[model samples]
Target chain A: MTDTADLEALRREVRSFLAAEAPTGWRDASRTQDDFVRTQRDWFGKLVRAGYAIPHWPAEYPGGGRSLAEQKVIYEELAGADCPRLLLSFVSTYHAFATLHECGNAEQKARYLPKILEGETWCQGFSEPGAGSDLAAIKTRAELKGDVYVINGQKVWSTMAQFADKCLLLARTSSDGVKQAGITYLLMDMKAPGVTVRPIHQIQGDEEFAEIFLDNVEIPVSERVGEEGKGWAVAQATLASERGLTLMELSYRMRGALGRVAKLIREHGHEEDRGVLRDFGTLVTQVDAVCAIADQFLDNRINGIERMGDASIVKNAYSRALRAYSALGLRLGGMDEQYVAPITFGDLNTGNWMADFMNSYAWTIAGGSEEVQRNIIAERMLDMPREPKGWVL
Target chain B: MGAVIELNELTDAAQKAFPADKLSPSRDESWQLAAEMGWLMVRLPEEDGGLGFTREASTALHLEMGRVLAAMPLIPAQLGLQAVIASEDFAERADWLERLAGGEYAPLPMLSAKLTQGSDGSISGTISGVFEADMAVAVVAQLPGGYALVPLDAPGVSLVERPIWDPSRRLFDVVLESYTPTLMLTDASGAKALHDRLSGEAQLALAADCIGAAGAALDMTIEYMKVRRQFDRPIALFQALKHRAADMKTRIVVAEALLWKRVRDESASVTELAAAKVLAAEAFRFVTEEMVQLHGGIGLTDEHPCHLFLKRALLNLQLCGNADLWNERVGREALA
Candidate 1:
């Protein structure tokens, strides 16, 4: 209650700032991945200079130390303004910041944290080809030869690795214990020798994510976060870094993008078609409900009353609504959406219904996939019985 | 924030009053208890000699009542009271409000009516979806003569019981044959405005009820899954069933969030509130259907409560403008 006035003031400030400075026609400008990255950096830099970026950072750092409610207001404003999401620097500002700030030593923090603000982007190198939803099953091996750990293995699905200057590398340092226990977390310079970054051509024809090959790439032991073989615990911090904020933002964006569906309905002259209207209406409410749940999820977190499966519920709800949103667009677009159109980078619901539909799958399949979130919801939240773990496939 | 504490207190009181184990406890006795607890006056203005509470308070009560499959017609009763309270032009508004608040039954029909007003201003035809009309002193039927409080004891006013699939509550058709209008709650000019106001409130209440019932249905299904075994293990151990249950939870939680958000939003249009209802009703329908299927053949039996929830959900969908009506309106509104 005490922060109500402060939050209003912050909201007002953000709104006025966004009204004047929020980029227009960024989607059109961001047709190519390079243009998208440039747009993202410009927006991120503007936010940083305006003291709106990295609100979750420490008080000593610029644009840091915002409360969860304040951070929520910022995200809400950004989404409401239709500003480009900070996809290129998401890992650097959140995942990397959370990891170093929580688990890194003072020197690491002083060295890397400042650089993130200086446009040094980082990508997660944790998900290997063998890992993904089963993240602990990573096969990337790291050997400590002397002062540096020689990392050798492949990491797939690393978002924006091609543009990243550093990587949150998770590699197996031991094999004698549980799969999760053998892992170690390190910060590796992307320009380091024996490191290769190749963009992955997605089904939607966007190279937002890339595959990283580490052929004995060396990361100084000083760059290692936490103790060796304890990276899984640190990785949890990284994975949990963004919390429910991204989904909340995305939900708002989706809600705002409902206009696209409305536009399609009119374009196709289905305004009088009760069936199409009903479907559009259903999707509208679905998106609205997702926004509500996302807001509730963050409110619960801010109130310190969030349950174990709350985030999973928010994630699953958001992904399903995203699927429904894009599906409705694709359905309403009909024949026109079937044709290939140039897709916008780093934006969902870009009015290109087919590409947007394919992009929706990324949400369902990535970030601990829909199936995994469902398991968490069922087993943890609902208290349903877990399947016997020892059964082999 | 204060409302949350009130909600918790209300929830605790509701659990104590109507335990989940006693499903659909004697409707007459439960109605009496609800009246005694001042639920009828929960939404009444404090200046009107009733507890001044926000819509959230009433929403909380409806939700809790819904969880137990309450047989009491609290929703209609509250809506009826709200209608009287909002009718400033009515002559006996205060007296009618007092009686309604003190548990005299005068419920606004949940569904629409088809009445023809003759040249002499007399009304005929029927108002359907009147819940628990057997105990009502009157029914709030919207006549072209204006929104009037038609007393059941008046001439040509009769109640015909219309049995429904949902046994948790009873329904009736308030039949009118040359029924003369009296106790005008609102004039012809005010009728449309009051109807819109109460319709929005009705949608919120039903949405809350649907969400509550869906939650209860999902809880029941999950509990049964944990205990019921097949193939030498609890059926909940299977991934397929667990995923379905999880999806049910997700739908309920999301819909509930929308319900609460809409309840607090005073600027929300009737279409928006109805949209909330559509979402909640659909979620409830989904959960109850899953409940019946997940419980297997036992769910089909009359003795099982799964069918009760499913029936209530189906009926709730119609009580609202139905998903089809509300959804189209919502789409139309969004387009504008």
Candidate 2:
């Protein structure tokens, strides 16, 4: 109850700020991912200048470097305002900047950190055809041919690869060694010759992902982040980010969705449907529990101890509740505008329901499928026997 | 406060204390070993020299049992012990209780049987999914008026033993015709009360099982997403999948919370109990089905153990009622 009150005040402040700064037509205007990215980067660029976006960025790296609690307040406000994301934050804040601060050599930091801080984006190119879930099976070959390593192989589902200015590339440098042992981590130029980019069409009809085909994409060996054949270790270092990322703001997201549902109920003239009422009750309770867990886990993660399983729990639950809530939105609205996106349902006020339901799949699969998370919980936490047929032979 | 005891720690200790090889399949030895540990009759009242824990503790015990996926009828026997604790005549059977608790005697709760009509006082027919029937010394049945404690060796009764998804809790197709019964209460309320309490408790137990199964399924899906790439990035980081995986986590957590809360607060209504059963059932169906789809090609086969989870969920899903049916009930209640 106390936290709810604090949350209310935070939400109000965010609502006013967003009302002033957010462009009016952005809500109904459907933009391509590229356009969306530019708008978001502009927003992030302002938030950074205004000292709101990088609240947790270690203060030195384009981040306000605020305390964890202060950072949580920012997320709470952001969600309260239903803020659009920069998506580039993943590259700038989590991956590249984190690498620069943690493991980067001095020159590497001097070269890349400022660019990232200034909003230059990088994409992770860890996954190869042979190395999807079995990331160690990557067959993307790079030879140390003099000062430059000749690169060859293809990368698919490279998030934002087409738009990225730089790429965090993983390649095998040795023909004879353990598959995971022969790898190298490099920050490579995206516009280098022999590099090609093709967008991958998702079932959701979003060209947000790309396939980067490499043929002799050359990078000097100096671009390597760590010692050769130790890319696997550097990649592992980046993974702690999985736990570091927070959904703390979902408490506010839940509130916003509830507000939309509440408005839909009043205006839709279907307030009498017992099914819809039950759906409302279920969603409310679900969001309540989800927000509670997220809050607890946020507090835990902020305290410098992480509950990885709980992180998985948060990612899985809220994503689902939101999807289910959207289904109820469609149900309550009588199926008239389910396919309509880029247009906010004015009377019903269910903005972006269709986009969200289509987009929610990323929650489970992105965080590691619920199954992979269970293996971690079972093996690492509960101490159950190793999952039969795990990553290892 | 409600009398539900949370003994996950105790049961975890029990599992470690009574590990599996000691209770391996085909050894009545596991039951004997469990009896020595007083686990067989942990739900029986202390007046009968049993542990006297309420039915809620059975959930904690079953959760631990599920961790190993052990092959035994431990949960049902404990349910039978609770039945004994609730009845005066049944409680007086100290030899049965001590033996039941001590593992010398095995009691079975034969609650689910296809209903049949009878002209007279006695009704007889075949009922299925009566687990451990072959191993049970005495089978207990909750009738319309009271419970019947029938010795397995009694005349006019036949049990066709069969395997179910959880082979540890084997199934039985039992046939009985106008069989004379023992230990009948003249009043019916006791029987209904026992039925309600145990069914609620049983559904909760089954829900806990689904949580275990769903937890496993989610873990598998996560692992597959992390390494299994479609284009270049781990398919997991993709938005479409990341959300579904997150959703599965939410469902399981809700089921876990409600089940635990019900156990912690045993005063929940039958409708509340039914709602939980319905939600837990649906959670499994949804989460497990998604698990298979997320795993892609390898998940669709018998080799994946994903199907095993589906099968378990399907059986339990049907038992307490299907989702649409229960959802309708919840709607009615919310309207009221």
Candidate 3:
């Protein structure tokens, strides 16, 4: 357990640092995708230099070896400061870092870890068009030709892949036995020959995600994360890396953005409307509960008491609150929201109610979907019987 | 860590006292057991000659009691005791405390009291939502003069059994026709303070109860889904129903998290506590609605205990202020 005094001191330290260095009006300045990427890189670099970026890493890395409580403090302050999320380096800091540090050999860690600190961004290549929620069913193929393996596949829904320098690629090594058994994890250079990156134009007009096409992209076998047919296990490490912290951060950010809703109510003269106030009040409590649950989830993780479906509960709560938050804003905004407005890049509550509402779908549809989370909660947490797979009536 | 351990111990003891196999166990027996366990004084300070346990301990007890649908009026009993404990002006505070700890029931009304003060200083109207009033020695109520301890046997005061849908406990109205106030707990300002404190406590207790019952309801529904076969297989094999069950579990877990967090936070406002209650009640509502539907026709019959949970959820929503009142207050406060 973490000492209260120690956590409070760390919180004060982070708050003072943020007061001096946190970016202001970054959302307004990030009018273009390139601008958003630039702002994100600058913030990530500052955090890395300040020793506040990779608190979950080992003591060997700067700003590392912090307790989960300390990490939570840092995230809370960052969210409170409304700092631009370290979006561009999200994969590099979490997914790639976890995969390399946990599953990669010493040589691979030495090669990639330092560059990540130097602002080399990474994106995941796990989800393909054919996979989505059933990630193990990915069809991307890799074949060995001497020391290099030829990779050919297309990956979608890879966040910020267009700006990434490296890719955490998963591909089929063989078609033997189970679909997951034949898979292998490899690191690919996004700028390598026969690789193409295309940004996805989302419904909210934010190109926050991108697609990657790999055609005969050859990579040395040394780039493999683990033994052949062990990528599924390694991918779990990557997926689990961002679980507690990101949601905690986002929940706090959403709580802070309640002011945006409040402002809308005031502007629309609905502050005196009991119906609108009730809706807003309901949303406020929902968001607060999400924050509370997210905090509890991390506390449980810190205490080694986390259960199978705890993360799913936090994710679902956060996403549902987010949807409710935006839907209320859209309703309160009325006719003005229906008219198109410039959307803030990478911000969930941008005051563009229509875009914000549309952007809320990203949470429900992505990251294993709401339905999949429900399955995990029902079967894993509540001990409900899992439906037999491949049941045909 | 000590607090969490205390909570677990209390929860285990409660489960042992009121097992799930016996739904709505004999109220008088459970109430006596609770008194013997010193649960009534769980939150009263040690200086006050009580257990001096933290809020988490009481919350744990409430949750376990809710799980089994225990028939004891523990929530109102505790709240009523807290009212006496919080009062400095009441001369018989210690005597009242001793009697309460000795298993003499005196519950505060869970709903608002519709009363008016006459020019002659007498009070009239009904104090609704008195749980198990037939067993109560007195009712802690808010009057025009302030908060007063009104003995049920006093002149012009009587208990009217209201006959509620929830069979897990009894509800009654304490009708006061020109009832003279006795045992003044607090004056106007002091009464306001105690009212705020008890309302906060009431929210936490109700929230814990909802969370506990919601968990049991989800478990019962899931258990039924696993065994009740349809279409030549257990209904749990259906993804649609399984997903709904998952949602119920999620809502319950999240609300429980909030409830536990708020219970430990001493500085939480009344509105914040009410918000926790609203979340719990809503989750309970969601779970019980699914509970009945998932159980199919058997859920609608009196043979099953599903309706008990559903009825309790609906009643809990109407207690300590309904979802509408608290939600509007929450919104109003957040605006500022």
What TM-score does model 3 score on chain A? 0.98
The candidate, 1 or 2, that scores higher on DockQ is 1
Off by over 4 Å in 3: A390-393
TM-score leaderboard ranking: 1, 3, 2
Q: What is the TM-score (0 to 1) of candidate 3?
A: 0.98
DockQ-based CAPRI category assigned to the predicted complex of candidate 1: high
As for candidate 2, its interface RMSD to one decimal place is: 7.1
lDDT by residue for model 3 over A1-393, one digit each (tens)?
679999999999999999999999998989898889889888998999999999988989988999888898899899989998888888999999999999999999999998999999999998999999999989999999999999988999999999999999999998888788988999999999989999999888999888999999999999999998899999999998885999999999999999999999999888789999999999999998998999999988888989999998898999999999999999988999888888888888888999999999998989989889988987888787776676578
TM-score of each: 0.98, 0.56, 0.98
The list of candidate 2 runs beyond 4 A from truth reads: A1-25, A244-246, A250-255, A258-269, A303-308, A326-335, A338-354, A381-393, B1-336
Please, what are the lDDT tens digits per residue for candidate 2 over residues A1-393? 125476566556656767777544544443566566666677777777666766656656555566666567767666656666446566666777666667789998888876765788888888776666667888888898889999999887777787889998889998676777898888889999998989877655666678888999999988998899988888877666533335656555665667666667777864566666667656655665566567667666666666446665666566667677777766666665455656321111235656555555655555466556655544444333342343564
Report model 3's interface C-alpha RMSD after superposition on the true interface residues.
Answer: 1.0
The better candidate by TM-score, 2 or 3, is 3
| lDDT comparing candidate 1 with the true structure | 0.91
